[model samples]
Target: MNAPHTPASVGATQRRRWWLAGAALLALAIDVASKSAAAAWLPGRPVELLGGLHLRLTRNPGAAFSIGTDFTPVFTIVAVAVIAGIVWYARNVTHRGWAAALGLIAGGAAGNLVDRLFRAPSVGHGHVVDFLYLDWWPTFNLADSFLICGVAVAVLLSMRNVPITAAPSTEGDAVHLADITGGRDGR
Candidate 1:
């Protein structure tokens, strides 16, 4: 049976939507702008600043640390799947934290995917623009930052046992939100 909506659930849904939209747009914008700036300013040679930080432009045709250098097309496909999965799962996001985390991941995926689709070489095989080298770490970009932060937030959320879906309703005769979304924890 379909359960009627309540004020609280409606508010939660609205909040989730706002959080997801805001986080995704902001992250995507920042990532794109940063990549553009890095490509333009840090092309010729590495620029050191803030003691140990270095800005170096690099084009990565692989995953993190330049792994899978021959699989740009595969990575492009994976990015699409990830973005779709996040959008599908976001309907059950009852917490702002989850929304923001998902948004960060989505934004990062899109940022990289854009490069893969339209940057150079060919469609689905373009290299990703990377910069922001620190010490001996691999050169990375804002997209990587967003992705890493999103994953860290996901781990923290899981460790806290916080429910990603709404809690059970107080009423006695209605189906629970948990039932509609998935299991009790919204996985």
Candidate 2:
């Protein structure tokens, strides 16, 4: 029989998860720095990276590519909650990549949240800085890119179940998905 584990080991693992939190902070720093530079140096000026496909130094204050700018209050409330939840869950994430993804997303969420809190000429209402504009699409920023990519990666990772070393007490053997498979189990 496996020995009962102590709570401290679980605490250690929780602390280890902060490694990903650091990574997310780095991403957030970059996003914030870039956005600040854009707002200060190139507010209206557009830096075209590609042939009308990519741009820089544009502000977006809205959901993914300026989708919900008009509804700033609603977005801000939702964003704050999501960021809080991500930070909390990040403490228990086992997979390194998933932790990293969560960090990136948390950073992105924070980058925008900070702007909403401080960058504004008003209170609790600041526009998020965006710079990557597409002539054919809406303008965006690094934080938005990180958020979308991170969420997509997170969703994909969540679809796959990670294997656990501990087996069910009854089976006394590690379980593979095959053990659960049936004619209709493929679904």
Candidate 3:
């Protein structure tokens, strides 16, 4: 049996949705701005930074280190699906951490999707703008950073057994692991 949502609970869920949207917009804005700056300023003039980091601009027609270069349109489609999934899942989020995590993921995906839809080469097949670089790693952008960090947060929350919605057993108190995983054995 499912418990009916109270007015307070509904309000909380709405707040979580706002958090998700805010985080996504913030991440998307930063990514788009940074990419534009990189495209405008970092061509043929790499700048070295601390810790072996460099500001170098490159356009990638593929996903992650130029892999699957032939599947740019597929990537765009996947990104759109992922963003939609995040928005759908966020509707029931009652946890602030989960809201932020989903928001960042959606924002990052949208950031790259913008590039795929509008940047360089052709529409729906444009290259992603990558600028930040390290000698040992493929060049990445702010969107990638947001995606990585968001996933990391989500993993941590899952490992801790954080509940997405309020559990009836907790009665507005802190959620416990058993309330989420059933027991230590996860059964």
Candidate 4:
């Protein structure tokens, strides 16, 4: 039988960490790239996708729907805190599912954080580039989509009772997801 703290277990944990980091990086890259493209081609104009779907490049100085328009610095601080929290949790990610979910959240947060730090107007007071405009929906970007989707996924996981906490060590007693979610055998 494999020991809890064996090198193999450690390797598995490392792999899990890589999964989270990789996913986050990929999401961030896509968000950044899409925003750049939108800025380049959609500025000052709107591109109709479907009937009500459109891309209208714009900069938002506040949170969703332009709330707190004068609190760019505050938003910047929140983003920093979020990124920090994600990093801290990432150190002990035990569930692959949570890794993916957290990755999306981290990536999305990082993307917007980047804009808040470097976009325009001033450092930590810059506006975020938004381009996606869906029927009657607030203008947003790839980062926003990722963030929303991530939250949805997280909620679903929680509903299913998937354990998101990490064990103190590979040798430590870990909670079995099957037990928490109730196994298919209904044991």
Candidate 5:
């Protein structure tokens, strides 16, 4: 029912895992650093940027658009679950695009989870630090950006019918379009 993995395929899968880990770490680091900078620099004054964009710090205890203000702990729990699910799902992600997508989502959720766990108002009730603002949109941070971008990429990949795991090649080591698209029509 399953073909045995060659050394080269194993190596490629390992590389994909490394890419996932690297992306997660990088996203987390950037989010943490940016949040710190925003907290330090945006307390007393808000910076006005181009095209109605501004840097204004706000601590949100709820989810997007400050929804469910009374359910801070619930959000924290959900984030933890989401991160765990992503990690579990990543084990079979041999495709680099899916790996990156999952990594970004996990890292972003972890970044916000850190805030929810230790920022303020006590553990599991802490507020997330949001600094970026726009006149038409609610305030957000880098972690949210990563999450949105990751989801967008994932959606695009799905629309293109890209598989999360590499498809086995029927002819030697060469992957054919039919193998990926499941048929010659690319459907």
Candidate 6:
């Protein structure tokens, strides 16, 4: 059996993963903090910044663009499933960049999953607090930013990686004798 690849020879193969984790953590913290601030200082009040950029307090109990707010529990379950899949994928990724992307995706999904599980009247069905507003886009949070960034990273990495087929090997080039004989030797 072939031996597993070693980290020593790779020098810094594990490097980029930390960056992904850090980005995801910072994003989640910012998301939670901003939502808290909006809840405390801007509740029910809209703040319009220059060029009509706005900040408004809101709760999203749904999927992207508020599609499933009324079914918060279902959304929460799906979020959990997504996080689980990302975590498993990240754990086994060969490329550090790909792992980072997976980690960021997992963490970001988990951050909002946390809200859906704890931030309101019911566990596993709480609303995700959203306050950042844009004139052209649906209101969203830091978790969404991380999620989108991760997706972009993953797409870029996948596009960047092209699999190369191995050349036919001397050890694998031997032909079966049965093909030459056109029948089994016993037959």
Best by TM-score: 3
Off by over 4 Å in 6: 1-3, 9-17, 162-187
Clashes of each: 0, 2, 0, 0, 0, 2
Q: Per-residue lDDT tens digits of candidate 4, residues 42-139?
A: 87889899989898988999975567888999989998998899889886676676777888898998999899998998999999998988888888
Q: Which residue runs of candidate 5 sit more than 4 Å off their true CA positions?
A: 168-187
Task: For candidate 3, write residues 1-187 as lDDT tens digits.
Answer: 7668899778888988889999999999999999999999999999999998999999988876667888999999999999999988887898877788889999999999999999878888999999999989988899988988889878877877777774333355334445434474466
Clashes in candidate 1: how many? 0
Q: Looking at model 5, report the run of 10 residues with the lowest lDDT sum.
A: 168-177
Give model 4 RMSD, 1 decimal: 4.9
Better of 2 and 4 by TM-score: 4
By summed lDDT, the worst window of 10 consecutive residues in model 2 runs over: 162-171
lDDT-best of 1 and 5:
5
Off by over 4 Å in 3: 167-187
- Supply the global lDDT for candidate 2: 0.68
Candidate 5 per-residue C-alpha lDDT over 1-187 given as tens digits, one digit per residue, 9 for 90 to 100: 6557888778767777777888888999999999999999899789999999999999999886567878999999999999989778776777777778888988888889899998999999999999999999999898888888888877866877788886533445443445434575656
Shift of residue 9 alpha carbon in model 3, Å:
0.4
Best by lDDT: 3
In candidate 5 the C-alpha lDDT for residue 26 amounts to 91
For model 2 the local lDDT of residue 20 reads 63
CA error at residue 70 for candidate 6, angstroms: 2.8
For each candidate, what is the lDDT?
0.80, 0.68, 0.85, 0.80, 0.83, 0.66
**Candidate 1 residue runs with Cα over 4 Å from true position:** 1-4, 167-187
Candidate 1 RMSD to the real structure: 6.7
Give the Å error, residue 123, model 4.
0.4
lDDT of 1 by residue, 1-187 (tens): 5346679777676778678778878998998999999888889988988978988899999875566889999999999999999888877776776777789988888888888998999999999999888887887888888988888777776666656665434543233435434466657
Q: Model 2: C-alpha RMSD to truth?
A: 6.7
C-alpha positional error of residue 93 in candidate 1 after TM-score superposition, expressed in Å: 0.9
TM-score of each: 0.84, 0.75, 0.87, 0.84, 0.86, 0.74
| Pairs clashing within candidate 6 | 61-69, 62-69
